[model samples]
Target: MNESLLGALRRAVGEPHVLTGDDCAPFLTDWRKVVTGRAAAVVRPGTTGQVRDVVRACLEHGTPIVPQGGNTGQVAGATPDQSGRAIVLQLGRMNRIRAIDAENDTLVAEAGCVLQAVQEAARAAGRLFPLSLGAEGTCLIGGNLATNAGGTQVLRYGNARELTLGLEVVTAEGEVWNGLRALRKDNTGYDLRDLYIGSEGTLGVITAATLKLFPLPAAQRTAFAATASIEQAVALLARARSMLGAELTGFELMSAVALELVPKHFPDQRLPLPAAPWFVLLETSDAEGESRASERFDALLSAALEAGEINDAAVAQTMAQSKAFWHLRESITLAVAAEGKCAKHDISIPTSRMAAFVTTTDRLLQERFAGVRSATFGHLGDGNLHYNILQPKGQDARSFAATQQDLSLLVHDRVRDHGGSISAEQGIGGLRTADLQRYEDPVKIALLRRIKQALDPRGLMNPGKVLPWQTMP
Candidate 1:
């Protein structure tokens, strides 16, 4: 960038907030370290006004801007390009919980407020913010919205898009759109809020948001159930949902390989039925009381056990035990990361066909690619699965990585064959840009481009993230 542009950026956000060279190194690489890039500078804007000013300055300089929050994204959605022409617009300084309306069950949180912090704030207000993920401690609500993140509790509370009531965004043209209404219903002509939610920052920068909240559950029960097969796990899920109804908050499935990694990686971790072919970490919650919740959980599991759907079961006796049960589920990602380099697929299929997809995909991987290990697990209640494959033991990491694209194609092609999405939760960052073009419908792709062009004509807002510059034929 020219000196004049640098000076303008420095003026927009103070000199101390404008980071350059080594100061920008950390933000250049993504959380997974899969995507790395170079940035002209990293700008820390303290407020929404400052964010707008920074955007205006970048636009004036004809420099692209990549908006980032928390930087805990699985895909490289927030990373800049290798050209080093983009400025990293880091929102950590805007971390603030603006307001908590207890009566309305709503809270206004800034873009950089940690997701766990928002949850705690809601809890302090005697409410619940239902978005729960493994990286909640550091992931920001802004990036969650940008990717339309879906976590374990999505079955109960819906994804990030549904949790949001309104958004405050800084458009690509450097205009602030304050659509931060806390109302539950409005017959608005056009719902622009939905446009930016999963746009992956390619549309505009999300600054703050009015989020929906719910009454905190009065009682909760978590249980780890073992099944003979994935099909049995699906049957157990149906039984739990049918019996527990709204009280069922989570239904997660993990293959034996996934469970084995926890103890292998996290030494302190332990599971009662680690050798089970498949395990479902399920939970039930009620507003009535703990006694009633416990009774329901036990009754449902007993029925499942009697029906032979579950081979074994363990219910959390205390809060600590409940957390431990959840820890087993949450630790899968970290454990897998510790294991070795693997190709990951966050895809979804019909709830009924999940077992068949897994069976078929596992067989295909074994038949086509010899000696690869698959660790499969995810939010079974919502039909999303994280199917990851580790390279054969003693295999060269570089040689194995060279086959990533081919391996991904094999899994994604099966996902398409089974009428599933290539991406269930994680958005198409620079990593899956080509996949989006290949798998997404041409008509939908065209519409997406039109919307992108309409909102970001100059294509300066996180260029080359979600949508490609040219429409796919």
Candidate 2:
């Protein structure tokens, strides 16, 4: 950038806040480290007004802005392009829990606030923020909202979009839209809050959000079980949902290969059940006491075993044990990461078609690529599965990379055949732009383009991230 633009940025957000060269190195790469980018400069604005000023200065200079939060995104969405001309607008400095209304069951949090911080704040106020995920410790609420993130509790609570009540957004042109209403019912006009929540920062910068909270559950129970197959796991989820009702908070499915990987990578973690073709980690929460929840869990598992829905079961005896069971579920990703490079698909289908999708995809991978390894696991209740395939044994890195595009096409085609989404929770970042274009409807794509043009006329807001690159006429 020119010296004049740097001067303007320094004036907007102080000289200390404007980072350059080595100071901006840490923010250049994404969390996964797969895609690295170069930025002209990194700007950290401390307040909403500062964000507006920075946006205005960037507009005046005609510099592209990449709005980034904690940078824990799986896709390279937060990273800048290779051009090294865009300004990296980091939001970490704006962290704050603005308000908490316990009676109203709502809390206002700034975009840069870590997700776990928001959860803890809600807990301090005798409420629950219900959006739980693996990167809750480092991921920011802004990125979560931008991605419409879904976690284990999504089956009961919902995704980030559902938990959000309103937003305070800074437009691409430096205009701040204060739509942070905490009201439950507002049918006044078009719902603009939903538009920016999952737009992945293409539309605007989400400064803060008014989020919904729930009464904290008095008691919770976690259980681990082994099932005969993926089909049995699906059946058990259906039965558990019917029997447990609102108490059924989570129901995760894991293949035997996933289970084995956990112990192989993390020696401290132990499997709760014997070796089986499939496993499930489930949890139930209620306002009632532990005894009641325990009895319900035991009865449900016994009934499932008798009905052949599950082969074996183990209910967590204590809180520590419960966390240990959850640890096994959480460690699957890290274990897979330890193994090697793999092609991962975060796709979802109808809950009923999950079993079929798994069976079909497994067969195709084995037949087409001999000796390849597969690990399929995710929230069975919501139908979102993280299906990953590792390179076949002794395969060269170059050869494995060559199969990614073809494998992605095969996985996405099967998902489409089952009326499933290629991206269930993760947003369409730079990684999946081409896949999105290939799968998404042309009419929908055209409408998205029109909206993009209307909101970001200059195409300066996180260009080439969410939407595929297109010349706006």
Backbone clash numbers for all candidates listed: 0, 0
Model 2 regions more than 4 Å off: 471-473
Writing each residue's lDDT as its tens digit, candidate 1 over 5-59 gives 7898899889999999999999999989998899999999999999999999888
RMSD of each: 1.2, 1.2
Poorest lDDT segment (10 consecutive residues) of candidate 1: 464-473
lDDT of 2 by residue, 31-140 (tens): 76789999999999989999999899889888999999999887888999999889999999989999999999999999999999999999999999999988888899
Worst 10 residues of 2 by lDDT: 464-473
Query: lDDT of candidate 2 vs native?
Result: 0.90
lDDT of 1 at 449: 85
